[model samples]
Target chain A: MTTVGEVSRPSRVADPDEAISAEELQLAARNHGIPLEALRYDVTPAGLHYLLIHYDIPDVDPATHTLTVDGAVARPLALDLAALRERPRVTHRVTLECAGNGRALLHPRPVSQPWLVEAVGNAEWTGTPLAPLLREAGVAPEAVDVVFTGADHGVERGVEQDYQRALPVADALREEVLLAYEMNGAPLLPQHGAPLRLIVPGWYGMAHVKWLRGITVSTEEFTGYQNAVAYRLRRDADDPGEPVTRIEPRALVRPPGFPDFMSRTRMLRPGPCTVDGRAWSGHAPVMSVEVTTDGGANWAPAMLDAAGGDWSWRRWRFEWSPEPGRYVLGARATDASGRTQPVEQPWNRGGFANNLVQRVEVVVVAE
Target chain B: MTTVGEVSRPSRVADPDEAISAEELQLAARNHGIPLEALRYDVTPAGLHYLLIHYDIPDVDPATHTLTVDGAVARPLALDLAALRERPRVTHRVTLECAGNGRALLHPRPVSQPWLVEAVGNAEWTGTPLAPLLREAGVAPEAVDVVFTGADHGVERGVEQDYQRALPVADALREEVLLAYEMNGAPLLPQHGAPLRLIVPGWYGMAHVKWLRGITVSTEEFTGYQNAVAYRLRRDADDPGEPVTRIEPRALVRPPGFPDFMSRTRMLRPGPCTVDGRAWSGHAPVMSVEVTTDGGANWAPAMLDAAGGDWSWRRWRFEWSPEPGRYVLGARATDASGRTQPVEQPWNRGGFANNLVQRVEVVVVAE
Candidate 1:
């Protein structure tokens, strides 16, 4: 990507394929993970979005790539990118979540990619509604599950097969679900799963398969490793645990006025200050977000902008005049389904969806 | 520099000349500012040293590079690299300090470059003693200050000139002050002033002029722009301010064992854990270092490793068994001269030499 010439301001992600050497690629990975402080930016620039690949992000060429829909269908269809783009296209903003966003906060931290609150991002996706595509295929009555297969294949948890996950036929036919082709008005970057990917609005990233290859409507439930074993929030060995699906309601605060996060301690001028962030929930739309500057002693309502649509993250802002001293900045989000973030989320086996309140320590210097 | 192939392991710095375009150069400048977190590595490698160039680093050819000593010297001498290397050489480990190490922390934030605490580094410098060179040239009794000039030129504070600083003749004559030609056992890198640099141990980096061109023994007290207008701690407009010198006593703790810093918060296990860090003082050798995990309520002495030398930094370690919870880690250092780090350094107009206690916030997960 051609970045503007500033030679000082940093961007989030780089093309892994073009990176000079293995060391340069390594440096790119570290440098591109945009710190959540960049939340102040309205549309998290393309590559700067948080990355979480289940196994591999197999490269796909748009010219040769095609999507095959079969099994429990009256007509099997193999549609190429040109044909897919020709269908009625819809653009919608949605927030994609990793499901394991707060895994690092879990005590006795469970198995999974260790992520803080940064494993989430809001972006605009342009695609054809999956319900229309599934309707055109004419699903049979016996079909119970729709399994999505990605071209990216690897042995995860000893299962040597293409990465697969199944959605109950009912959720698969939801009008909000998308066969996404574009992100934030631009074609997807490779690290973000280029060519074709799913955009399961209101669901964690695992449900949104990248490098889409095949769609199989199954007669029986498909228990893939991702759905049945990995991504499960297990309480104990006996409990098979509930599969992680919908994104948990959560919010993260950035010190307002957009300061450079190069420093460990957030410094502020002791006067009129603002705290702002983004809040998202998959179960329902975010209703409200609250912020506390004095360690939860008193919370104040924050203004939230939801113009991006129901499934998209809302920008939250709060203004406060603070005195010169140290303060613990805290924020909690509540969703339309009445799910408010907890003070301390219970630790689970795989550390999925542990969205405790987000807190940041800030120091106010004399003005 | 050939870095060993560990694709995921992060390094502090990289060559800027090879970066793609000026944008990549800016990115390299930002990404290469080695995070303060890299201090976990003992003896920061040559290229990984923290860099803050005041002006463009002019390239100097080793074949033609020479140090010209004139002014009040009884006999002026211009010595080339080979001639200087013929003299007795010594390699010594010393910590270099930037006068603006904590400029960002200053209230009203007075400087253009808002440097945090990562502006310091320790390295092994190989060179002949400056005192002996001056002694051979026969220093005149009238010499008051030894002025050092570097080839780097720029317009700083609206003045266009090559960088320059001065040291009192007494301090310049100290045996430890080195006319360094090599760094960390290798010839100095271009960014590091290549042909030669002055190593004024126990003093801030302003005293260590890189790309050394000329050294003049001034009969009158030197009043250069760098010495008179910058690197001074001023409280108000009328205050001429005291020139900042000598690295202050300070210590930074790295988690006991090497732990990945990918987590937003430093992750540690419950039960016995060790934490270690580096400490140094300019006025004298670091006599003691203490750590406080309870936010300054209590202090515990830490074992220090200082066998390297008086001018070198001491590695300090502390063992603690912390209960599962959140903690604010703090460290302070004391020097043999009885100088101790303060809890809060008073604010200065120019934002120079802010050395307060260093604190790190960490999380302890249950095992």
Candidate 2:
């Protein structure tokens, strides 16, 4: 995997595996369960995506590693990275998102990871529960928030840069988050958030801090660049215009977009056909997903899997035999919060907050 | 720096100062400029904290490296790493929190990165904004969330993993979250989330995925494992009776509990002695913090800096000239939501959400 020093603008490597056939590259993306559209590009190709690290990548040899928690605590706790690993390990397949995953769409597009379409992906993370660590830390009652900082740095406001964010002490002690040292069944690649990345499943990617370094207990707020200026949302240029800081309940279209543009004439059987896809939301299990045959005009409720946690996508399918003609297939999702997909795309300068319904074009043929 | 594989159950590294000094580490955590806490065991040490990566870290070797954005849009965007470096750069500091920063604190703590307090950190991130990437991506009206996936992997539910998450299309395009390849005036390290880590300031840590592999333009949410489960607050705990799957807004206590053999006698002082400390909240900025000098008798308001974003921590200070003796110093914080710190701590099976008024005993030398 690549490291911070190794990462470059998309154009450099262009294609990491150009040696492989295009068809194979596409297949690889698919085999990796990536959206087919993601593989369409070649040189740092359009729509192709990658991930980012928010901190300095530290170099730790497995032999000498320790985790300690002290200060404002009952017992100054110390645990080696090995000891942490020795604890019972619990694993889960969750997603780590970049708060600006879709920021490129925003107008005056911010100067950052020039992500197009493939900025995000799914992974199974494994680690011990953080709760035990806090227990080991012997959290003091007065602690307000546990501030976590990373080893990465950059100048912010002309000052030496180091990033940090705080989680409520109560929340910090939760068991869901992990001091993850592995990703997708492998040791974290330096380029993909190597050892000790915070895996916060339900919130936006910002919540999943990478290049993790220090955790301090404090009774105040920690303000840094990424924590203050980025990943904010506005409510349609509406009244009061307050940014939504917390991860709003939202769902995603799985097998996102059109899948390699299935030839309408080829897959066309003048009989009832099944339109299938996946749906998922942050935090809550997906409640229901609606399918729109003709845009939003006619809506048919799609069958969905039993509600799953906000951690995974829910596969949904709708059976529909299209008449011999060209038509647009759209899907709208709704979570437990009743927040459904919007028909009209939100117009933002940066183009963030894109929760538009999924529209796919399909044609039917009569032999 | 430490890699995920390098992080053992218990870390072994000694305090900072070797690579990153402990005082500087403490400054990184305590400095109001970017209030961050040193998490981990101090092992994994401040300099060796784990790093997740995104967009391979691009030092460019200065002689090589290029970036380009092209896709199903109106414009084909391209830039070499040099061009990106040359492009106007905007710098800002904010907190990048892991959505699951407090996951370990959740009840029935879900299985994942069992990060205690070490999952989060603060840094002064500097890099080009992502807005240009969006412009390059040619975001369309149909686009929804911008998805991000990293190169890291682990097994969850018996499946190989890749870290993934999504940002609102708008946020993803913002220039604040940068394609940061540098850290504190240096190229990114392999473990420090090198190359380009999304600086989704103000959001949780998960949003800033590391070891970036790809970015995708989508009309729906990016529901990947790391993005899905890592960051979440269980707004619904159902009365300590039923098991909860989510985390709640919480706080951590430092110097947890009081020191043995010390009583109020050690706290009383003669004149003009200041009792100072800090306070913070997750997902909520500290609005006002209060100090109780008389064991809850008389409350004095602590000075607070202007509230920035919700992801960062607020620093507070209070001055009190003690009457010549030992006295207990108590401090509490309140957020914009009118949520104030509790006098007594809240109890949970996981020992999370332990935010309570902090009491510190200080001895004052009478003049």
Candidate 3:
């Protein structure tokens, strides 16, 4: 491990940019132009960071950094990163998407950080469940919200301060939600919220605070800038619809691409190809996924990766022999809660919670 | 140009996938560790495509394919691509944004082809103004809208049909709107609506029809699937907000990187950096751009490229020198209409018309 005073730390990454060339990415998704399929958990086990944050990747030394629990708690506790890690550890593969994952797909597209679907990823998070920590701190009965603050500070909207978010006491005490320090079986990257971060499975990425510093038990409702001003399902300039929470049912079919057409990539070659995708829902388990090549002309079931439990996206695959022609491919997902990916997603000004069907276009040529 | 068949198309590209290695993309944005600066459009003239469309890039022979003007026009006319091109050519640099450009950034993030800001592109289009053609066609006084039909066909939102869009007769007659035949001074690529496409300056990309095939002068309002069911600024499932028209005040900082992180790229070093970006407004000419390196604490005006007329994004730049630290950089734009990009944007069910100020975080380290 490189120390803070090292003359020159070997590049955190051999190549500072940790991205595969579009050509390589397309080659990886060469299954009948199924581009989303290129995002396989086996190949890319770490989850994608849907949001592009340009903050300092703080080099937090486990020896110095500490997580504090205060406010209405019976015992205000402060624990360093290592002491926190020594607690019971848990691991689960979870898929996390920024609430704004498909923000650019909105019609009057918002002017915020334009995010496409890449603002998401699935990963193995190993850390202590949040509930154990909360219980150990003896939450006061009157505490209604659990507020979290991160080490990264910035000026957002108009506020310049550390990133902060709040969860209801109930959610803060869930067994699945963790204070994760390890991602994909390794320590978290600085960009991924190193040393300590909160991983609220089933919630959007915003709820997962990186470089976590403190947890506050609030008797009154928490209204931090991130909680009150941002992340809302906005409607008009003045009307803030509601606070955004939970992931909606969604699926992605990765595909190969031709140069100049990353969005509309085609496999080029015709004939038989296996198509597959990943599906998930924060509200419930992804029950099933159906595929259609000719719009909705036909539907076919796909083989699925056995349940890795809730919060993680499920992998599904199908095979087809498509002839030389233009086709619109689609994937729809139904969750265990009886919620299926809608033909049309509900719209909001803040561009929140759009769980509509994903349609991809492809032109297959003769092999 | 190669014909329908030849020894080979030399492979439109060496590989179908055109993404750069993620590492390289990340490194390119390492200036002072500011990632968003990676979005550098000055280096790329033809902007980016943010839409997800699937259809064979038809190799239309201009000799065979024709543009027909019919419906509520006095003299119905049909003209081949060549005849259309011969009609007084005009060229202008304009920016095109998919109506759903920020859709992925919405709150509950839609599942439809997730589009972030990459759905926008600025290009020099050469074509004849639609107004002259309408005047020649003697548009009936009763005509309310001019409907445009593209030769391309695809299935969207479960509808299998050709791509189509319409403009109010008044809007259609605007000289800035054109029956474009070339982009960036060259015949559009097949995917970019080869042969002929409509270039509706200052309007969302949906207003520009690719593969121009038909222009119908309609006395009544036009309600095609693209207009009625899809592309509408929807509210709830039932509340179709309104037809999305006109480009709002928006600015983009072009950066380099992998396909996914197109909007955010950093400059890794902690030295002097010249930052530049493009701004546009369908509402009016871009008046000015303000940049801030110390968050919103201070704002400095960025030098802008003189107006090249309307519809195209204005170019702006700012130079700065910094020490080692983390910073949140921001860019906000103002238009001739006296409208400035908002700190937060109104949300629509379709995630439409979001023009929030953009903030980019960066980590500046010692050179």
Candidate 4:
């Protein structure tokens, strides 16, 4: 029931850097079509975006917290959280995307909450490598899978939403696989998954669990839904069939540089106006963004920010003109591999990969 | 600490049946070493044994009590409890055993409230065949699992316990698989898994889910703990080296015709008195139950019951002269397959398969 104007502009916007009040940010997130009440959303700023982890948060108290690393290993260990914190730590800026991001566009559109292209976010995370811990646990190279269990529980869609999905051992021991305890230089906020979380970079957000509790190193693949069901994508161009296990790198194409539409009010003549937007891809860095004002016939390149994180979305802006009438603005984003956003997205039972070129409508006034 | 007499004989017990008063039964059960308080026994009758289902009771309004059968079938159908009740009904006498019953017997004896062997009971159940519903649903012969989900949530050992377990389609569609609407030949009791429950005869209590909600037919096996972890048992003879799935049936043995010690007091003669005990096994019936007055050396065969459930224990008895002396009475139950209870149960990280020859100490009276 909220109008576009009401969404794009809120009465108050919280400054992300300023111990920003959550109350205002909540309203702003709502205005911008984001759900801040879903889980631990400690630092989910209004404009910066967010990620939705499919797993329930694990409850761990300081007194009873211990991480066990065993299975196909030379040694087994039970390390407490405090002991784990003593290990060398690393920090990295990365983006996590829920496989179901933009999934609302799929046909027969799944029976879950409809997402509106915002279940993706970038953050600087700090944690220790799970690889070293596995090494310490004496995990054999022959290990096949790593299972993560959280403290959260509930029944979702007739499924026992107990422990989350398990990842392949190869994925588990990745150097980038962090047993993260902090986000954006701050202790994890409860809503965004506090205490500890697992970060699997370059994969859908569902893989990175929030409020992580138990880590079981195993010798086989754990194919439960979050990994096997939720993060799935179409297999190939030929088969519009059922989705496969893996997800490919894809980007989102938004409107040109966060331009203000009100600026066009003073312009009497049909002249050039700056159009602004954002672009982000899960697998690779954004290479370029293109704009198509005359539908899909002709395309023009837009300027993009060069200093953005590889996982972070790139802001893009383009120059466009109106002829005293209605104008439809279109934008497409390309990744490093030359993979470009499609004009129309494929449909699936669960909406995923809905990266169709985005269009914004506007009206120009006559002088 | 409260005295044994005071703690054991609280005058508060709820009874659904008028056969025995609450006060008298509370004193009796306590005298027999049962902890009536820890059970959270809301309604405790002296004659009828207490029944405890693992999951929370589902609250079903008669107006919306419909059971829906869908997927991989000839017809997807929904039947209300009224319709199910009106259908041809059948009744069967069965005993339900919790997977963790006698769990305290495990070595290293996992840290749980030690059980005094009172977690087993038998009841008559009434309901319509689930097989007919499956047949109407057109269940494929190839269907491997029938998963039952319930509406109960509990926090056990810190894990959310919304219960779900899958049974082989062959096992699920059996003639005895009842969508039970009644327990003990009476209208279904709320606390005893009412509304509807799955009664899988011979399987552990985990297989009989309470608060039945939905059943899903699948061609794959469910790997949740209730299926994959809990209820699992290893044969004492099976090499400790192999990892297998099926659980061997076991049984409990109790002293026969107890409280008879006072009946023989009229003789006014005391030397060395002994009492006989009973034994039961889950698989292969009760081949033999031996009683030992001197630890477990001297053995004597105790009488066995004429009729026994496939997975039920047999009552046994032995006698000795009543003298002023203290003795440890031990009873070991052996299944037909030569599997005997060990002096101390095997050790497992997960407290499971705790079947040990029961040991109880008693003091003989002197005249």
RMSD of candidate 4 to the true fold? 28.6
Estimate, for each residue in B59-111, the C-alpha lDDT of model 3 and write its tens digit. 46777998999999889999987788779988977777767655544565443
> What tens-digit string does per-residue lDDT give for candidate 1 at A1-367?
0111111121112333232222232222232233455576666655446666544345478899999999999988899988999998998788887777766445665434545566777788888888888889999999999999988654343344577889999999998888889987877755566788888899998899888889999999888877887768777655788888898888888644212212223455567766788888999888899998877778889998754687878889898888767777879899989998887666777677788886676666553
Cand. 2 Cα-lDDT: 0.47
CA lDDT for candidate 3: 0.65
Cα lDDT of candidate 1 equals 0.71
Better of 2 and 3 by DockQ: 3
Q: How many backbone clashes does candidate 1 have?
A: 4
Which lDDT tens digits does candidate 2 get at residues B217-328? 7766656543443332333333323222212233322222111110111212255544444445543566776777556666778886554444444455556655444455
True contacts kept of 3: 0.05
After superposition, which runs of candidate 2 have C-alpha atoms over 4 Å from their true positions? Answer: A1-33, A36-50, A54-60, A65-72, A76-78, A106-111, A114-119, A155-160, A234-272, A307-310, A323-326, A346-353, A361-367, B1-367
Question: Sort by lDDT, best first: what order?
Answer: 1, 3, 4, 2
lDDT of 3 by residue, A222-293 (tens): 988778877888666677558988998887776532311222334345666778778889999888999988
Per-residue lDDT tens digits for candidate 4, residues A1-367, read 1211211221121122332122221111111222211112222332234533232223356567666665567777777768768888998677665665554334434434335454666677888888888777776666777888765553333233554767787777778889888877766654455677888876666677766777777767666645554445434323334433223444343332111111111112366877666666655677888888765667889997663564555667777776765455677878777677777676555456566654444444452
Residues A10-106, candidate 2: write the lDDT tens digits: 1111132222122211111111112322222111211112344432234454456545565566777666667768987877666444444443333
What C-alpha lDDT does candidate 4 achieve relative to the native structure?
0.53
Error of 1 at A179 (Å): 0.9
Give the residue spans of candidate 1 off by over 4 A: A1-34, A256-263, B1-367
* Better candidate by lDDT, 2 or 4: 4
